[model samples]
Target: MLDLAHRGARLAKEHGSSAGPPVSLLDQEVIQVSSADVVGLPMRCVFALTAMGFLPQSAETISADELIRVRISPAWLRLDARFGSVYRHRGHAALVLR
Candidate 1:
């Protein structure tokens, strides 16, 4: 997940967009990690990001079967350190916002 975040930050830097990479990218990353033991991880990722203010609190939730869907905004990747220790590992110290 931190790798994905770093990739997103790199992409944002390349594109010169302060908002970070598209939410779909992060969503795809989460989906890739989804498994029996990691069910609903995407929702949890969204919730965590939202809680950290990386994502907006007004995100809409959609329920389908056993899965919950949310639209991640472009502004959801501010790279703020307040987001948590996840960004601190994996050589991502440079990506964190001071």
Candidate 2:
């Protein structure tokens, strides 16, 4: 998932996206994460990915924390996996999580 965000930023740069990468979503900062047991982690991931344009921006007013706390549907998981794989293949496969 982090790879996807990295790849998204790379592609965005290649295609001339004007918005600079968000500080929190920077590849340097993101790659350091291995495991986290923090509350709202999923919400944070969704927010970060969406902010990077890896995931489409949502129009719904539902907060990320609320949505994640309620449920993580299988379909959403599949989408995450699909996007991760796609980005991994596109030159972000070097990420090694320990």
Candidate 3:
């Protein structure tokens, strides 16, 4: 229920076309949210809270991956936004996100 669709739209509107996917693939879809695409403050708070152990992740599917994904996705987004050129050399956005 992270509501990424809304967040993505907002991000696109805010940044306009100046900010695009940091990495692009020839024929793949990127799964991670961009830093410029997420709701800034909320993602930061989620990352902090997850790091502090207040939001413990369980071994179940949802807890295991979603928790970590949500926590790190924003960081990846930030990295992509700031250092996209560097990452693009390593791999496409989909690979990095995965």
Candidate 4:
């Protein structure tokens, strides 16, 4: 997936467009990964972008999948941050010890 995204980003860059890469939908049966797990891909994508110096350290995850779906500028890797927010917010919340 990362390879695909890189290739896509390269193409977009060569074309002098803000668009990144083509979106790909993996088959659950073939990949054997749940939808919940699938969500991680976006986060990884963001991390990849960050690693590539595309975004800053304070950068947050947006809806990359949606951005790809909407045909908006693909330069930014947007993704649903709800899953990450859940864990991040929980860590800040009061911890109840049973």
Candidate 5:
């Protein structure tokens, strides 16, 4: 799991408020780890990896079958960290992770 996986993600919440689902950064790193179709997200820099930073997801959920679906046109790629992760499914809604 990437370092970012240990932090709390402010996913699926209203904008500008300190309330939402708390996702551990250490866990939930794999939806279908072996699936080749899975898109990986990169681990951002120190500043970008802070608690104030996260892959803003507009909509994310897990089905009974455990199929993790995510939607982001411009996936996050941290060239420096060389780490990859994924944002929860959000269709096309613009969400801020900070």
Candidate 6:
């Protein structure tokens, strides 16, 4: 999903989105990943979900429009044959404990 985020960051950068590349979401979790894990991930697909996950809930409420407003990169979402869960609000700062 980060690939999407990076792309979105770039798109936002290029298209003049008032929203930044989504530092709000990026800063939410404490990442416990290695450069190796990042390498293992399909960068395009992984960051698609990541892009959505990091977006802000409008009026402090999560909604589908808010959820779907930001589209994940098609190339990123379609490349994988496997799946994983995006865990949120755990006891610690957010992390993907692979």
Local distance difference test, each candidate: 0.38, 0.38, 0.33, 0.33, 0.33, 0.37
Q: How many steric overlaps does candidate 5 have?
A: 10
Provide the TM-score for each candidate, comma-separated.
Answer: 0.27, 0.23, 0.21, 0.23, 0.20, 0.21
Per-residue lDDT over 1-98 for candidate 5, one digit per residue giving the tens place of the 0 to 100 score:
22234432323232224643433333234322223445444322222433333322212432234332333344442222123333333234577788
Off by over 4 Å in 6: 17-98
Q: Over the stretch 1-98, how does candidate 3's per-residue lDDT look in tens digits?
A: 23432354455466556654222212232244444444322333333333344443332423424332322343342222111111122225455433
Q: How does candidate 3 score on lDDT? A: 0.33
Off by over 4 Å in 1: 16-31, 34-98
Off by over 4 Å in 2: 19-98
Query: What TM-score quantifies how close candidate 5 is to the native fold?
Result: 0.20
What is candidate 1's CA lDDT for residue 93? Answer: 36
Candidate 2, 1-98: lDDT as tens digits: 44455465575466543566444444332322222321122323543546655443444633444321212232232124212311212234467789
Candidate 6: residue 59 lDDT (0-100): 33
Per-residue accuracy of model 1 over 10-90 as CA lDDT, tens digit each: 654675445654555444435433223322233235434544555323324312232223322323321232323212122
Model 3 TM-score?
0.21
RMSD of each: 15.8, 10.4, 14.4, 15.3, 14.0, 14.0
Off by over 4 Å in 4: 18-50, 53-98
Model 2 pairs whose backbones collide = none
- The sequence of per-residue lDDT tens digits that candidate 6 reaches over residues 1-98 is 33355554564466454654445434433223333223123333334455444434233444434322211231221222122333322234545778
